[model samples]
Target: MKKIFLLPLISSLLLFNCTPKETLDETFQKINSEVLANSKAYATLGEATSTIGHRLTGSENGAKAEEYTYDLLKSYGLDVKYFPFEVETWMRGDVEVQIGNLNKRNYEVYSAVSLAHSPVSADVDLEIVDMGNGLEADYAAKPGAVEGKIALVYIGILPGSPEGTSNLHRSEKTALATDNGAKGIIIINQVDGGVLLTGTASVTGGLIDIPAVCIGKEDGLALKEILKKSKKRAKITMTNTSDQIKARNVIATIKGSELSDEKIIVGGHLDSWDLATGAIDNGIGSFAVLDMARTFKALNLKPKRTIEFIMFMGEEQGLLGSRAYVDAALKDGSIDNIKYVMNQDMSGNPRGFNAGGQKGADGFFDKVGEHIKAIDSVAFTNQNSNSAGLHSDHQSFMIQGVPYTSPNSNLDRSIYGCYHSDCDDFDLVNEEHIRNNVRFSSMMLYALADTDTLPARKLNDAETKAFLEGNGLKLKLKIGGDWRWED
Candidate 1:
């Protein structure tokens, strides 16, 4: 009699458990259809690049881009909001360099560019000291030799790093150079054919109290050869203008139908370098986010958990916008509500998604990836991966013990010469690429939000520290002076 009574209850429980997955699978179909049929990601990217140009953090073009994105999100009639923050604006001025004796003060004028946040005027006259790769050990090897001299380092890691070794950020290299009392820093660009790259050498947004500049590979090598025969001295004259200005982050909210407290963040930064239109660097990723918001509104698709579509600013200047967002949320105790984060920086043509956490996230990502592939085997077959990398907005969320996601894209490497250069224009963008990203990413977002029980959980303070150490980042963090845990 007891077994007979329990049979009906067991069947009811099974039906209840399977119902949400069925609903989620069906909803995923609708989202993919809506995005594929009518996704304006490429068109909107074209418009944004043509109209506002490169959206620098504190420039007039930056303000225009902010307004454009804000108005576009406002059109959806969702709960759109703008979070503004102050950033120190950095801009370039006349830059000049020459090498040789003071009689002529002229050896050759190779193409050189100024790094951001350098001193207002650098009229330094000093001898050059080549520090290979600018690794920490290089500074330690020659104590008291770099003071009052220009330290020259390669912008990219040389071709000789061991298999298990990782290179530090360019700014971190700069920090090491500055700590050793170097009067200035000269970074050599890896791109051939006289391509000069300009980026912030200061790890933090603040100034480094030294002049930083980048020269081409050919020119840098020529200088090194000249140093071999005799002492090589040079003169550098540069002026960088800066001011404090307000920047904005645009956010659009779609409330959950059932579980209102649980939230997910879909984020991308809108700021880019002032050299070109930045069409591929960020416009594709961020405009795709904007199009996703439009698609959700057009289709009236409501999931079980809330979604926040965010456009950050000041990413080119060291992730100031995303850091501000995370700090505010933590201060107000709203960080507990967030369950997942999807960061789309420089993303294009999604082949799959990256599960950015420990091994526990693998099972959940495999289920979702397989289900999507089943819908369209030709497109999403064998595309997803369970991997992670640092140096994007995802780092802000990951450090807070949140699981994150990013597009596993197959980008072309030939055009890397255009990155941070004046050639990252609209010509590099593809129509099909942006559309594909929108369709696939929209499907993934909906599925994540609609699933009944998410597989990931937030780490406690101790657990978060353990995760960072386990990932083998403690040494890198210690070198960069970001280590918070004591021995």
Candidate 2:
């Protein structure tokens, strides 16, 4: 009888110990179900927008936003920390722009706003030289045309430009104008119906000697027509403020249970252009990241590699916040431990992921995409891309040879017209779309964190230079003074 009892107890113990561990597929499914059922991304963003409004770095609203995210992450029971940094930031002030013919007393006042980093005080009246497209080739076409005068350039490439012409950023155009000896610049907004846009005009993030401002598309075109009839002079008078300020970047860490030494960073800029609420500009991206952290904690996930969810500030004025973080990482020698970085700036409705020119990452993401597709075949089509671009937080890491990727966004075309404009409000966001960002991106983040080994490794100096050149970003980097390689 004793032997039979002992045999039955041994069989029960063996059965209890044989329970299977959860697979990645099962975890992904759970993530999808949990997000679909209970996601606070949309609601949290709504609260922040309705209450805090635009989160411009170094502003009161910006500080509030920082604290808000910090508290939320703390509520999620994650290891949260604030990395503070000092930066000289620029703010908009009073401005006035007028246009009239040369040698005329009266001028036609046009609706315009001063671009960020404009002169602290400026009063200039000069002839408006229309340099088409504002490319170096355009400057070559018209020698000494924009010298000591006001330059008028289109915000986008003209319709009849060369077939392979690449457009420059507004800041780059301003830089070209300054380098060509222009006294001031008048950028024509591309949007129709008198919509003016404002962003940073100085590439160096320092106060520019000449004033720069933007005018409505209709007004600009009408001014162009008048100039065709006769020469016109533009008067840009503005007063901006530049001061030193302190800003903080919020980082929430989910420590890995197994491979704690390896790290994956998922970050988005919490700061936005102060034209409007910045709801679509980054509300979708940053808030989605916040909720992803919440989801990971709620599910009690412990990936093999640690993940750091960061909300970066000072992105609109420049990449100040992310640059600070990367600098700190480099100083501490923990930069090598960072294996991957995923940035989501203005990202929504993820159709696929971009490999960011990282070698061997395409196959890795493709395999992971299948699991995402299993969750929602229609929304997540698993079509990945291998493109890379600049003017985002990822550039800070990409330059350091850390591999990066982002969701291939499919935002509405209409909404894009409001970029850096006043129309980027909470109304532009769709609930299901932002939810999709959280679901799909969180899955990708987990896959990178929990995988046995990452396919992409940190590139050395030569390999990084080759990657940038191949992606055609070398010229842009040189233009922005970010090129580290010798020409």
Candidate 3:
């Protein structure tokens, strides 16, 4: 009698244990279907790029962008918050450069937009002096040649350039010229037959105290001719301002039941240059992630781990919002709970998703790449071994030893032509491409979150140190001796 009762009880327990709660594959399918079905990608992207317009870092538009993104996420039923941070603000006021002495014909020239954290400037003129490729030898040959004259350096290095070439030729040329008493700088375009492209300055704050401008090849040539003919020299005058500006990061969380503490982050930046709307630069990424979150909630597919969608401000300003987030999370130990981060930036171009990350995460990226290929002929390249970090907001987490990946396209000769210019508008984005990227990234996140075992954190101390040393990073070593920390 005792044996029969115990056997039956054991059988009942086995039956209860055998019933499955939910499989990873099932959750992925549900989530993927919802993402595809409720794809409002285009409309959302249009509103983000056109309606709210350019969200320059630390500007009123930047703050408004934070509000817009937070409200959108909150409306989608996710727990939302604004992560406010301080950034040195800079703004572009009226800027003008004119050329008239060449053949005595006046030609209008474009002026550089003030990059975040750049100093204010007043109308001033500096003698224009051409520094060939701005190389050290060129500077040495003409020591004091740039003295008291604004150095007109070419945009990129020459083909037969020297080794250990400092990537700061353009910046250094300005600094050196300024230190030697030059009033400003004019960077010439390196394009063979293309117009010059002006961009905002780097967001690193300082008081080097000089105005810099980028001019087109045509304008540069015109100025060159003027310098050659005029008894005096070519001149430029600019006015700008720098002040304390406010910005914020938009955060939204979709809670899970089984593992609420662990998180998977997705999304992109909301800021852009004031030239044209930043449709292709990052509007697509923001919209796709927003749609993904909305779809998941509408389908009521509760993930095993929480999904956090962040729309960062000041990415164009050197990833200020994301960096602030990482610093805070690392200081407070909140980064410990993060499983991984999948950053979607500039995903709407004709090209497919290209994956890159730390070395140990190669296998994970390979699997994702294979999956993307199976869905569509989306090309994927593994950049794990090279350790090319800090190109985007993803770097913020990777610096803190977080396993993260960014789905970006390769920057071949063809791709750079349209990036970060007035041409990066809605027409530049391919709908099919954006859809495919969204599908791939969403599936990857769902698969990772629902998996029984997390992908092992494989970046040991040796690998981490080698990476940091090679990349010129000064990192604080952890006591565990398995990872590095950022001081």
TM-scores for all candidates?
0.89, 0.94, 0.81
Q: How far is candidate 2 from the true structure (C-alpha RMSD, Å)?
A: 2.8
How badly does each model clash, as a count of residue pairs?
A: 0, 0, 1
Residue pairs in clash, model 2: none
Off by over 4 Å in 2: 1-18, 162-164
> How close to the true structure is residue 333 of candidate 3, measured as C-alpha lDDT?
77
Q: Best TM-score goes to which candidate? A: 2
Q: Model 1 over residues 316-343: C-alpha lDDT tens digits?
A: 8767788789888999998989899988
> Candidate 2 — worst ten consecutive residues by lDDT sum?
15-24
Error of 1 at 389 (Å): 3.6
Worst 10 residues of 3 by lDDT: 474-483
Q: List the candidate 1 regions with Cα displacement exceeding 4 Å.
A: 1-22, 101-104, 137-145, 159-166, 478-487
Model 3: pairs clashing at backbone N, Cα or C within 3 Å: 196-216
**Which sections of candidate 3 miss by over 4 Å?**
1-28, 100-117, 158-173, 176-181, 190-203, 225-232, 349-357, 377-386, 410-415, 456-465, 471-487
**CA lDDT scores, all candidates in order:** 0.80, 0.91, 0.64
